[model samples]
Target: MYLTQGLHRMLQMNPAALATVFRGRRRSYGELAARVARLASGLQGLGMQVGDRVGMLGLNSDHFLEYMLGTWWGGGVLNPVNIRWSVPEIVYSLDDCDTRILLVDDNFLHMAEGIASMAKVRPVLIHAGDGPAPAGMLSLEQLIHDSAPIDDMARGGNDLASIMYTGGTTGRPKGVMQSHLNLWSSAVGRMAEHNITPNTSVLHVAPMFHTACMARVVTQVIVGQPHVFVPTFDALDVLRTIESEKVFDILLVPTMLQAMIAHPDFGKYDISSLKRLTYGASPIAAPVLERALELMPGIEFQQGYGMTETSPVISISGSENHSAAGIANGRVRSAGRPALCVTVRVVDEAGIEVPRGTVGELIARGPNVMLGYWNRPEETAEALRDGWMHTGDGAYMDEDGYLFIVDRLKDMIVTGGENVYSAEVESAVAGHPAVAACAVIGVPSEQWGEAVHAVVVLKPGLEVSSEEVIAHCRQRIAGYKCPKSVDFVNALPISGAGKVLKRELREPYWKDRKHGVN
Candidate 1:
């Protein structure tokens, strides 16, 4: 049940097999295992304890895999920072979790100093980039070369494995604590649903910090398959890598899939080797799904649905649901049945199970569910009630046991596959000096399934333009969480309790949409 057990199994079964591929670099299982052990030793040298949190601020690469395995091997928990977050946000996470060791790649090296300066405890930085280590930082290569190989610490079961931070409703990030068993159960459940082919290569185009992508990483390790990585999601790079690497599987959000299919040079690549395409983070539009099926006729498309709290897998719509027959029957819209390890139900506010076709909050109880949010006992209790994780998502279960998500009860917006809490955005918008009051809502968008839109009430004498408001928000929050558009209004509709009526603000934008969410 230990996360690093897969590495040991791979070493015993196929030591010389290709384990990781990134850029022009490739590492065999033997080499990867040895390096991981050495990296574990290095962590111990840097004062990492059995339950210490090790953070990585970087892109998807072979080194990222090493860091994950090495941390577990050293008996340290993972705290993979969000790359899109600003330095203040990053510092907040590091400070919140007391992360004292951070690995930074070239893309994030510039922010390391700022993070270290702002953090309550300045983290020891390890350079994980391809180039030479900069001044005042330890090199990842040097650490592996200098340190002796160490045995796996064998931390497993309920031991904390990762502390992934997700957008919070209170305008901050909440660290979701996932145990080794939670991750193992999730990966195993997914494998049971759709088995991976032997010796196949899986592409890592999605951000490694994300729970969905990291779960796939664990699944690949368990299956002992080759991992092919791209630093970031670029349509051309993904197509080229698939053709060059002979990739068998990939996980993408609907937006990334659409971009790849719509790319002008997409037809030039020989991507017949790809066997499976798993998409999630947001529901795919029918037209986009149709186009993807038409473009990649051989590839099987599957949809997964969940949150960071569920170890990122609650249900998965199989390839069959994406088929023409399933679409005709309208089953394609479902999030599919609960995973093998999970028990899912739609329940009312009173915690009673609702009848089929009744819209209610989706709740799940499973081994894969996260332990709780770090340092937030009250919030944890509020989310995990009666032994079931109350997912703040509005969904309905049909007679066939399929779940259909209609809205996000938490007022969370999924724009370009990234969760943006309306409260978080509203807080930033209201920070502007010219603003009196503001309400943020998700508006229907063609490019990004849902775009963050803000309704603002300016002060009596002050005025601010849309661009100015957006610029102001950029200083306080991530770019993705900033409002895509802003509308000046006299006043927002409010309930008797002094809360903004978001539905009224969202109504015009989602007028003809069947679901409240895009």
Candidate 2:
């Protein structure tokens, strides 16, 4: 179905209901619907034709949501630029996808100018921030107020909805083509796995540019839930918002969750309204999960597992899977079963389904699978082999069909003759009492071809020696999988989405080597 159908339904059925809350500003469904339509008309007037690529470069906000809906509402495709990318990287994506219209907030307004100067075809910039538009940029407010509201374009099914660029493993970003069916299936599939109510108030803290959070936004739209937006994630601000707004649901990365639970003033807020906490991008450490459960006794936790190519939701570890019952059954450690619309299999290089407990690539087949990569047909064919999207993530399925992701196939360390998944080592290292965070990677080794190397960050005022870290891991996992060496760091290099960037960690070590892997 069309993405804007939910908005249309909301306007007809509950126009007076609260649609969004951002920084003390609240808009009713009627107001939001009208603004969205007007914004669509404005973009149309600015030369956005059907299936034209439109870009948004900004932090999360109510305006960001409007841009998303308004783009599809106007029968256009979205190219949401990653906020963390440099001018050159952002320019590459825009140039690659031929994004002609770019939306910028206060943070990226200046960068927008830089992008415009460098691009072959300078884009039309729409300012979507609080202040007035700069000299050349179009004001978002002016557009909505001046333009007449238009009807939804009703684009659906195979229509291209978004071209989401993911940071490429090979150092160049690739645009993932997500159709309307891809996004719709993911949103509705997730809703089927959760207990979303009419009164569900979802707090969107993660960057809207990421597919994980955007998928959540679509689900909230379909359910007609009130949305609360924060420009960025701050531990104190998150806690305060939860208390003040009586928010019911939130999505966070494990690192963000760690900071929130560790905040000294966490107990000061009355957060009983919080009922659901959904996390993804990385697996949660046992300590972090235990602390979260202890702190928020009644909250149901869900772990979503997927990447940008699958409209970002493949499997979901539901509330029960995070509870005592499921944990005892070994489901908590799993990525959970496939989503309502997805079919998951652990396949070998030959694309044959491996026996249960055999590690192989986790391939998924579903309507939620992306249409293809933009302008990368060879890569697209390589990824979408046969009918399944080969996820490049190394995982194994148990007898119960719960998928346990080991590591990225590229990130797996081949030491001597054995394959050592980095996640296995990281999980063991994280269990250390003094460890705050850790990432494991493969380093060059004359003896073993590639050695397991662990980079760790300890809790403040706490220390653990490299020997101790290795010794701890030895008790939990195999010696080959254990770190042969450890380097203690103040912090791990993390992506904007809170995942430890292993590629960055391996870069310095692998710089002199011809190949990426040892």
Supply candidate 2's per-residue lDDT for 90. Answer: 91
Where is model 1 more than 4 Å wrong at Cα? 412-518
Clashes of each: 0, 0
Report the number of backbone clashes for model 2.
0
**Model 1, span 1-518: residue lDDT tens:** 99998889989998999999998899999999999999999999999999999999999999999999999999999999988778998899999999999999999888989999899999999999878999888999999999999889999999999999985334578999999999999999989888779799999988899888999999999989999999988999999999999999999976588668868899999999999999987555555667688888878888889888999899988988888898899888788889998999899989999999987889999999999999999989999998899988888899999988865776878899987767557657766778767778888889999999999988788988999999999998899999999999998774321235676788788779977764
Writing each residue's lDDT as its tens digit, candidate 2 over 232-337 gives 9999999999999999999999999988998889999999999889889887787788778889998889899999999999898888888889878878888988
Model 1 global lDDT (CA atoms, 0 to 1): 0.88
Worst 10 residues of 1 by lDDT: 494-503
lDDT of 1 at 175: 96
Q: Weakest 10 consecutive residues, lDDT, candidate 2?
A: 191-200
